[model samples]
Target: MDGEPVDARWGSARVRGRRLRTVRAHAFAAAGLLLAGCASMPDSGEIRAVQASQGVDSQVRVFGVPPADKATPAEIVDGFLEAMTSDDPQLETARKYLTPAAAKSWKPSSAVTVLSSGLSRVAVRGEKDPEGPRWKVTGKKLATVDEHSAYQPQTGAREYEEQLQLVQDEDKQWRISTPPSGLVLSESDFQRIYMPVNKYYFAGGTLVADPVYVRQRTDPDSRMDPTTQTVQSLLAGPSRWLAPVVESSFPTGTELRTGTKSLSYDGQNTLRVPLNDKVGNIAQPQCKKMATQLLYTVKDLTGSRLDQVELLRSSDDKTSSLCSVTSVSADAIANRPKIPEFQYFVDNEKRLVRMKLDVSSEDQQTRTEPVPGPLATVPVFKVSSAAVSHDERRAAVVSEDGHGLYVVSLVGGGPMPAQVPIGRGGKAETLTAPSWDASGDLWVADRDPQHPGLWRVPGGTGTPERVQVAGLDNRRIVSLKASADGARIALLLEQDANSRILYIGRVERPDAKGDVSAVSVRELRPAAPQMADVTAMSWAPRGRLLVVGREKGGVQQARYMLADGSMVAASLPGATGLSEVAVAAAEDESKPKPVVAYSEDGIVWLPPGAQWRTVAAGGRSPVYPG
Candidate 1:
């Protein structure tokens, strides 16, 4: 009874005149009943059968295992590399191409080198031997995803090569006996199997998070639990690219408690994480901070399944609560200062004026008047760029002539002073815009190629001191912006070919008190490699960067990019021919932070809807208080 009418058309045809009309009506009613029956829900057995079919189809590996009996050494090596792309739970299918002992000892989590697509090659080294044969694989390396799944731009070696040793088992089957500890995959495969996860760290003594890519497995029985793996990676600390800048509260050697199986969610959707004895020594404040880190990391992995984090400390075969907290109270552990809602710029009159940001309104327009201050009375000439202090009471400005750097009080009482000289000749060859750090120190870079270097002044006063920047030799710094967190600095360097590159360097201060003698810059990492000329850049909320630049064959545009070199397309339709960009990094949760740029048309702003609204005509440099 598959809910279909039986011979209704025949009945209508056989009936005569008036009887025929009635017969057709009955046939129509029967057809409606048939459709109604078909619309009913399927039985439990039928539903289960459909779900089973879908599950099996999804479990099919991306790379299939090939018969090894007739495969060559080079073929085995290629197969093993291809198998790394599979999402097979424990990678058991990948293990089939490896010798039993090698498979057991191999650690794919050690590292991952993302190779350029269509550039990989495998070569057999020599003739086959009784044990097996050897092969060499090489490709162009794009980036390195470390053990913690943190990505770093490949700096030195452009080409990657590895030696693979294969052996034949008793059944005469080819298998990899001595493969590399880590795995290599194509760029497309890496994107398909991995996702970005941010790990929180403290910057300028305030809590902040940095993004890193982590592998996401589809198999329920995968060897590594994604939730637990994420927490462990966070404890491992920031990537090499960012470690020098950010600080992690977690002590060295922190790990999950022994005998703990996996991270689990309880009835209330709270995540219970039991850690080793190392956490027993952490103070109450630090314990809560650690809990905050765990909460964010786990929530990102499990989505809304986790509401809070309950940390348990294991000792004497017993577990006890270290701390428990939610995302709401996490701010109590952070010492971040409030950022101003107004945007400031030097007017055509050479006076400083601010425009208030009304994020609530549909237009999101700026206020009409500027705040009254000493800057209004002071005569600032040809201002190229200005950086507002963290307190919003002071500003540091650089002159267009590239000679003088001056600090001026924003509140109306301070005396108008002379320009701070940057070099020995009472003139700077070229001076970058000055930046104020949380500690009230001002930093600038001298673009003099003969003696190119970075300099720091105490609160934008006193004699400038040279800072040692590692790996900055032979490159000219065109622009510099110090991050509000005070842990890193963004630099625009000009290469020999006249191409501009964006780099982030970790700022290291001296340990000894009053030791302004020297500061070190280390672990420099590239942020935007595709841009041929970067006109301007600024830091955005959550450690992202707002960059304005032109690609090789593209028009100039502004876009957001993560610290790990991932691009986020923020549409600014009317913002073209942009010269500079700035962001408030507003802490307000109720409204979207405002971003402004100086386009050829005028000063344009991009608000919540990504629409470019004009702020002022003929405005040059736009900035927000740190």
Candidate 2:
């Protein structure tokens, strides 16, 4: 029977006398008989054993209950708030707690206010209203999901307060007269109802992943499932934070064909998307790009394999063929990072060294060897920290004194190249570790007290240009990591002894005919505001950061977080006491490389589903290819 209310009038009816009591007893007897007829325990059967659930039940679904008769004003307000968190497809049950006019005007999908816990509802003692009683609902806001499905987290726990008025209906039953416009849910409820999905867009020639949230099932207001809703959000362009750096291939007004409500895969494991006439006349190349974006965005939504995505355009009330892209063709358009052959680090001898990746067995003691280039044969200064290029052909090394930066070749033998002068003259411990973006450009930060700034070297071989960081109020960038897509950068900054913050900024450049000198960092938003201290971080696959830090009044640990500032269900199982950590930026994330870190035990490697094991006894600054 799916366990829903068959009839609720029995609870709302007003009746009296012994005859009504007898009717209630008869109704209860009839229900017992109906349930008994379905199944009965075999009292004399032989005993048998069955397996019990091994873990907590995750598939439990919540249903809303109707209000009791003669409910008080506070009860009405509290019931409405509880009903908002239930998974009602159309939210009709939640509307039952509201007045007719208020129900009609309330739009739950307008926005979502997420709190750390359930809201507190209390009666206003001295309020005087002619037609209703007043109650207050308040919470500490943690985040908000906008109408566009973008998840934005707030730094501080801001106060959120609203008033709910209760009035009597024609039958004199209490109901909420005024209701909030959007859904106010606790953090646990929000996680259960919504899921995180990525939409693809172009940043210059590379594809970037923009993370957003969508309802887990059919949306209450839109009536569209998660796949269709994600595609619609993709056509609406990137989020406001990412709109400045990325562009969508879809046309300005392009949308799903009219009256489309759901999207599914065909027998060939292919998805065919129908678009409106606005994109009917696009070229094959442009159409392919659009299909590629859709293929990546919705590939993981369903259990079935998504091998290809074909676009169908409407013309004269008839659908015609547009271009299509397969999984193979999409890779050419998306510039994902290449798999690295080895993980690099600074050894006890202060030289750049490497060890083979994907170690197949526990008994396999892979030997560590020096790199094949000048950094191995003709070293000039002691190496403190380093970053390998995405292609694994070159490495950027910082001097042990932390005042010089040099780019060294790892594949070809040559003399050690001259240090890239970043103009941080004569200052000790001024230069941070160097990082390489997917476009082959190098980035570094100078924390010199006199000239604190960020510098980018064009092509890793050109003059360094100091980039201006917006919204950095008297803070110095201490460490930095540019994303493999070259569209975003993560920075660890400090303002004083007590102020340490981690921020992710959008990398912007002017359209002055490919002028690389005009590049600057803009819109530095907090990436890990929940933590009080962030010691180390590196760019991980799928546009995430592998962070090492601790929350306020907590101990240090390592965890992974999305670049959009949303939490995920991922963290190092027992990786503690880590001073630094690194993750490989590979294209295929299904089989990730081992996490490399440096701790009190020296260089440690954490293979998937295994405890951390020491590799080198005296190594510091372990790193992977960007």
Worst 10 residues of 1 by lDDT: 35-44
Scored by TM-score, the top model is 2
Cα lDDT tens digits, model 1, 1-626, are 12222221101122111111222334566564221101011211211111111222222234335434667555565556656666655666677788999989877778888765423444444434444467656667788888767887677878887777777788877888887777676665566567777787876566555778766654223355667667778888877666655667777888888755468788898888888999887898888888877776667565556767888999998999988886667655555545575777766665556787775565433464544554555363456667888788778877666667778877776566677767433355477767777667788887765667888886667677887888887788887777766777888888766577889887777642234535777767888866777778877766667788778988877777776775453535543656644433443332456777776766667777666667777666677775
RMSD per model, one decimal: 12.9, 7.9
Reference-based TM-score, model 2: 0.86
List clash counts for every candidate, in order.
0, 0
lDDT of each: 0.66, 0.76
Whole-structure CA lDDT of model 2: 0.76
Write candidate 2's Cα lDDT for 233-337 as tens digits: 999888888887888899999999998889999999899999999897898888888998999899977788999999999877788779899988887887667
